[model samples]
Target chain A: MKVKTKHIMNLFYIPALLLFVAFVVYPFTQGIRISFTNWNGYSQAYKYIGLDNYIRFFKDKNVLGAFVNTIIYGFGSTIVQNILGLAYALFLNSKFTGRSVVRAVIYMPVMIASLIMGYIMYFLVQYDGGAINDLLILFGKAPVDLMSQGPRAVLIMTLINILQFVGISMVIYLAGLQNIPEMYYEAASIDGVNAWGQFKYITLPLLMPAISSAVVLNLIGGLKLFDIIMALTAGGPGYSTHSLSTMVTNMYFRGQHAGYSATIGIFTFIFIMIVSNIIVRYFDKKEVEM
Target chain B: MVQNNKRAAIWRTPLAIIIVLIHFAPIYILLGMAFKSPKDVTSRWILPGYIYKQNFDIAINKGNMLAGLYNTTIITVSCIVLIIVFGALAAYPLARNRSKFNGGIKAFVLGIMMVPPLSILVPLYTVMAGLKGTSTYWGIIVILTAFQLPMSIFLYTNFISAIPTALDEAASIDGCGPFRTFFLVILPQLKPITASVVILTGINCWNDYQFSLYMLQSPKIKTITLTISSFFSQNSNNVNAAAAAALMGILPVILLFLSLQKYFIKGMVDSAIK
Candidate 1:
């Protein structure tokens, strides 16, 4: 009976495992293989020119730009998101009426897909009669064409990304704040710790676990930023706002650079693997000490 | 001290309110302008003088919003149901059995949760095409299921393990087989995690654009996200109609979120922090 029950339990795993292997493992391996080739994505004939695709990718100006932009997007958004999120979470942790409503409102953007949010942002940022420009005109100031510049466009993209996701970090931080014993705060208050001191010594230390998770999750999400960039800028005013993910999509779908696209994908896979693992390890150690 | 606390609330609450308002400003613009005519939408008016019904008509008739909505509903519902069922079932054995195999599977699922789907985009699309999965509802469903499975399983397994082992023993002693015990005794107890899985996966599959962009390229099979996206690009000149399409497309998901926000927020925090 025990053996049969064990077999049945294993049987339950078969469907999920099969689909996972086929869809995830198989394609992942194929992506690696195609990266070493010189396939144009149309004709069946192609040759594996070892390391040439990776070599070209390293040399390509656009690829390098995208790599840098992805890093900026990831780190830039992660930093801003954590700071703002922690602040909001701390504020919301205080007693107030309509608190849940406020949290839901703040988190509302997180529910909207980034792709749609990007489209809405485009309307607001457009130069001619855009909402932001119109608001500026109302204020008797000259309108700024924000998205026209490469750096500014990337900055706005990062800001938009931050706005959409900060609530997630906030919610996470709030959960962490809830986990801390109230007696700690009470004891600190009795001992005459200032707000800043209490926060620095009590809240911040207690919140480290939440901080690590939020930062790493946000970092991963920001690195994978694509739909928003695609919808808002299409990696332009030029290729200035392109992340590696968007660049891969563009290379494969539009530019007909299949092998090159796979190479970028592989590069992204390895890079993300290294970066995220390093972050997770670093955080795991911090969490233990805290 | 009480007075000081009151004073702090006065400033803190309003500041929090401002932050939320700022976050929602774009959505407000999107909805406000969606009802205006093209001229009024582009103008400096905060709200339209009168609502124009033509925007919705145009969105439905021309922008493919209706067909997209229909397809999106089918896909989202089907995907959510399958995710919950499969995720719970797979998580069960892993949660109950303490073996090296289960341990490896758990770790692999967690690792897959971190992998960016874009890393395998080209090959996944190619393989899907070979299987004739592109442009088909089931194909996209399968892909979404596979991609979302790791997270689903992780959440479910964690939740299930917290449930007591005595329930399984109780069911088995009552003359139930493993499958019957699972379906009858264990499955019903999985409501909370199942709710989490539903909201998380529903929002994901509903709002998905990247996969739909490549897989469901055909006009007839386009999801609401794809429809709204293509409409925005094609009709950039007509701001009102585009906003209308966008508004209509997002309304369902927004409504769903609003209704289940308690679960939604809890699920998010639960899934992430674990």
Candidate 2:
């Protein structure tokens, strides 16, 4: 009975394992296989053109641009989100009236579908009859088309992502703050430690875990940004604003280069896996030292 | 010192209020656009003076907002149920048995959580196409469940690890098999953690766009995101009706979040800081 139950316990996980194999593992291997061929997604008969996709990817300026944009979206959102989120957490952690109300208001956007948020921002930023442009017109300034410029469009979308999801980082920091005992600060104050010193020493080291969590989550979310780009710019003015995620879809659907698309998909998978692993390990090291 | 502190509090209240207003601006614009007439020619900043809800009517009747909501509901509910069952059942042994193999299983689960589904978009879609899973509720549900299961397993494993092993031992000594012990003893104790799992998974499934977009291509069975997106693309001139469609898509979720504020916040902390 003992041996059999142990086997049963292990068997419980098989269904989950099967799902992963069928959905994730199988498709992933197929993605690799398809990357070697020139399958146009509709054709059953396609020839294997070894290393052509990789060679094209290396020489392709658009792919290079998408890579650069992905970096901006990923790291830019991480830095801005952590700063704003920590600020919000520090401010809201105080003894203020209607504090919960403020937190709720801030967090409300995180619940909104990001794609819908992107569409809503469209109304505000459209060149003509837009909410922001209407406000600008009151001061006799010309209406500016915000989404027309590729770089600015990327930044605006990143900002949009930051605003919507900042609540998450804020709450994680809040919970981290609450986990800390009040006596640490009280003791620091009695020992003549300044506010800055207390924050630098007591707060920073202790909040490392939360920082790690928030940063990693933001990085992953930003790296895979697709829906907002689609809703807002649709990789417009060229393929200028496409992240690797959107680039893959655009390639397959519009460009019809299924081989290159699969290669990019594989590249993204490997790239993110490497990046996240490094970040996790780096955080692990920092936590150990602290 | 006392006077300075008093002045600080006075300034603080207005600062808080300003922050609240700024953060709430997106919804404010959405509301303005949703309620106003298309020909009003007024700035989105201006609110409608009278009750004009024709935009919403247009969204409901023409945009198929009701059908979108129904399809989304079915997909979200089924995904949540499968995720919960599969996640909890898998976490049992991985948490209970601390062997090398189980440790490897636990690591694999965490690894899967990092996979952005967009990475597998092509082959997965083809696999679905082959299985005739495209445009069907069950196909999307199963796919969503598979993707979300890893996070659920991670959360469950952490929670279950904290429960006493002695309870399992005592149940075992009382002539209970593994299945019996788990269903009766372990499953009941998972209520709190399960709430966290449910809310977190529920939000992801409901707000899912990329998966729904790729899978449900047919107009008749559109998800909320798909329907709203198509509305924007198809009717660029009808901004008011599109905004109304956007508002309709989000209202239920916003209401749900406001009511369950504590659970939502708690779940984020749980998912992240663990």
TM of each candidate vs. truth: 0.97, 0.98
Q: Can you list the residue pairs that collide in candidate 2?
A: none
Q: Give the 10-residue window scoring lowest on summed lDDT in candidate 1 chain A.
A: A1-10
* Candidate 2: segments with Cα more than 4 A from true spot: B1-7
In model 1, the runs with Cα more than 4 Å from the true position are B41-45
Residue clash pairs of candidate 1:
none
Best by DockQ: 2
lDDT of 2 at B150: 95
Can you write out model 2's per-residue Cα lDDT over A187-247, one digit (the tens) per residue?
9988999879999999989999999999999999999998889999988879889999999
Give the range where candidate 2 chain A is weakest over 10 consecutive residues by summed lDDT.
Answer: A1-10
Against the native complex, each candidate's DockQ, computed on alpha carbons, is: 0.69, 0.78
